[model samples]
Target: MTLIVGHRGARGEAPENTLASFAKALAAGVTRVELDLHLSADRQLMVIHDPTLKRTTGVRGKVAQHSAEDLQRIDARLGLPGWPEPCPIPTLEQVFGTFPDIEHYQLEVKSGSTAQSRIVLAAILQLVERFGLQNRVVVTSSSRTLLRTARDTAYPLATGLVEEYGLLDPLKSARRYQCRFLILKWTLCRPTLIQQAQAQGLHVSVWTVNEIEQMQRLIDMGVDSIITDYPHLAMRVLA
Candidate 1:
């Protein structure tokens, strides 16, 4: 069976990455979830998709520039389902606290594999340790070097390689980084590729899948997990 991972916490039902979104996904019966992480100015690890806050938060600054206090006051759900109701951006700590039973959390780090981003990885590792989610989470990133650094940290969490720029053989990067998962874009999730990756002992997780036809196709192809904006629809499709 294909595991349904709520993309940005059932983004179709609620604002992306907000607590309300996560609650809706759980209500939709999704146990696995995919979220993005960016470090804030005050060193708080924030759970949001972009390094910049323009798209989601409607603010005109980078997430790393805002302190936790300032970020808390911003209404992340500007015009979404819970408009004007103050859905402040949540910390990874808050996420773990609210949903103790979330089985698999695929966290994508938004920073590149640069030297300075090591701080970002370190912060994430600390949070994972604090919440005891090291075993239940997969830290995914497009940067192979960053993943290598993460692996060197001796953290037990699974590492995943996110496909970028239409990577021809994402498995190569996964192998290089010793990643257990291949985070494929929906377009790259072909049956042959899925089978090949699985045959080589790699789990394939496709992302941003929302269409019923595509979901059914991926399920038929035997994907290990499907990250989607609509978990309720995914559940029905699987059913």
Candidate 2:
């Protein structure tokens, strides 16, 4: 059976990447969730997607420029309607604390384009060790260098490669990183690719899928996991 992984914590139902959104996903019976990470000025792993706060929180500045305590004040509702007011940014530690029952988590590290971005990998690895979630989390990045850094940390953790768009050979990429999972872009997922990856011992997990038809298609393709903004739709389609 294909498992549903909430995209940015049920992004279609609630604000993206917030505790409220994650809670909604878990309530919908989603055992896994996908989230993004950026380093705060104090080096805390903030859970918002964008490097700048303009899009999500409307706070106009680089996320790395603000201290965690300061970033907590801005609302991350992304100005969407119906969500509670003052939806502050959530730390990775906060998300882990709030939803301890989630079976699996896919965390994408959004850092700078270069090697400097790996600065947060050590912190994330430390948290994974502290939380005892070493087996439950997969750290991924589109940047191979950063992904390698995570794999080579003092306490290395499970690693996955977020394909650079839809073109890279999933099986080869997984082998290169020694990644057990491949975060395949939703559109790139096909039965042939899924079969090929699986044959190579790589579990294929497609991302950001929402439509029922597409969800059903992926399920039929036998993907190991489907990451969707609408976990409800994925559940229904699979059901």
Candidate 3:
């Protein structure tokens, strides 16, 4: 069966990357979730998609400019109307603690440079190890440097390559990085590519797929998983 991974924790249903969003995904019977990570001013692993706060938090600063404690206090319910409650930005540690039994976690590291990517990946791996989730987590990133760092790390955590534009040679890069998954943008998924990736022992996971027809197409194409904003809808369609 094709697995359904909630994108940024049921983003269409709740505030993206917030604890409430994750809970919503869980309630929708999603066992896998995909979330983004950024390093805070205090160098903590924070669960958020954008490097800036304007879109999600309606604030006028970069995520790295604020400490984790401060970031958590800011409400992240900017885009979604009638949310009815404040949804604080969560830490990677908090997510792991709250959803310990989740079948899989696709932790996408959003970094600007190789140096910062390494720093964030190190912190993420340390937390994964601390929580004994090395086997359950796949550290994914669009940054080649970050993926390279993950490949070189001695930690047993799995790594994945997130290809947004198909600019790079996806297969070659994934093979070079020894990634366990090739997370492609929904627009870039094709049956041949999916077959090739699967043949090479890389699980193909498509991202940001929200439409039912598109979801069915990817599922029929034999993709391992689809990352969607509406897990509830996906669940109903799958059922």
lDDT of 2 by residue, 106-173 (tens): 99985464456556777887888899998998888787777666556533677787874766666776
Ranking of predictions according to lDDT = 3, 1, 2
Tell me the lDDT of model 2 at 51: 88
Which regions of candidate 2 fall more than 4 Å away from where they truly are? Answer: 113-118, 152-155
Model 2's lDDT to the true fold?
0.83
TM-score of 3: 0.97
True lDDT of residue 19, candidate 2 = 87
User: What's the alpha carbon RMSD for model 1?
Assistant: 1.7
Taking all chains together, the TM-score of candidate 1 against the true structure is 0.94
Whole-model lDDT per candidate = 0.84, 0.83, 0.89
Candidate 1, position 79, lDDT: 32
Worst 10 residues of 1 by lDDT: 78-87
Q: Rate residue 161 of model 3 by lDDT.
A: 91
TM-score of each model, in listed order: 0.94, 0.94, 0.97
Tens-digit lDDT track for model 3 on 31-133?
Answer: 8999999989999999989989999888999989999999989999986878999988889999999987688999998656667877887798899889988
Query: Which window of ten consecutive residues has the lowest lDDT sum in model 3?
Result: 148-157
